[model samples]
Target: MRRSVRSPYTIDLGQLHFSLQYNNWPIGYVESTNDNITIHSGENAIQFFGELQSISSESYNALSTVIQNFLTGQTSKIEVLAGPNATSYPLLAAGIVGLSLNVHMPPFSEQLIASLIFKSMSLIPSTNTRNVMLSASITIKINSPLGQQSPLNIQMMNMSVFLLYENDSVGMLSVYQAPVKQL
Candidate 1:
């Protein structure tokens, strides 16, 4: 006779209390609307939404103007505040909050890769030259379930991205946004 192994025991807290702070200002708590920030706990996920003005109306307007100036190439960057009354974070313009995304890229077949390689090799001349040049096209498909369900019309803009580790800059990549049909 074999004895069945038991699963690990676990405890779930029905309700949890926590305080949220933005720019050092206490925004609000989860599932409560004392301030501008509002959070909702679902069966599988927790969602929250808030605006920059929620922290402080004065800071919001000031940051908005600063953002406008920066976008117009007037200012290099907006200032960051980190004092007892600080309410500003760098690169945080007026926008929505609590946005989440799940993106994935599916694998392609080897046949497609072989076809692209042959087409690219056709560009090279069949001569006794050591140096030859060739070019190939690469297709990258990005999928997001939440994005597909969104009803709002979205337009992506060109932006520069910098990868950093431990607050130190590592590398940069320039991204150009374009529209693609969902497949």
Candidate 2:
């Protein structure tokens, strides 16, 4: 299924430019398509933005929702496959590149959750540390007949910001702020 996520005021670490448009991600199918023939694509997509420290998928909707949502949306597309007498739909992804990085994620402690906000940043220069204002968050919905919803805790004990860097792109080592509040 197709899911939607909205990101407001995304930062461009390269040119230090702020994208004028708010980020919208239709990630999971919210109300329709209860099956799993899925596909999705995006530009400047924020699904997994930085070096993935930790990742997991609780539950997901069907494949058709992914295809239809992507086909009808601007950030994504759906492809139709035709054979002798059959038709198939799939989500299009140009290519896949894996990233590897070494990061220190300190365990969360009472001292850590003591506050309501935590901050984090990618490897950046000392000069740029003061300039790192980028942030990311997620909103999740639980699938059930009652239609319950809640934001899942994707953050670890350590409040680390997930930042993406292009191949050959490099930033300096700096301190980041990522605040977290216990629910």
Candidate with the greatest TM-score versus the true structure: 1
Every model: Cα RMSD to truth: 17.6, 20.8
* Best-performing candidate as measured by lDDT: 1
Give per-residue CA lDDT, model 2, range 1-183, as digits (tens): 122434454422211101111112212211122222222332232222111111213112323334334334323232222212121212111111111122222222222112332344243334744454444452223222111363345344343333448754344333344453434
Give the least accurate 10-residue stretch of model 1, judged by summed lDDT. Answer: 85-94
Question: Candidate 1: how large is its RMSD?
Answer: 17.6
Error of 1 at 57 (Å): 9.8
Candidate 1, residue 61: lDDT: 55
Candidate 1 local lDDT, 35-120, one digit each (tens): 22212343223233323333577555554554344334453222222222111222221221232222121222122212212223
User: Which residue pairs collide in model 1, if any?
Assistant: none
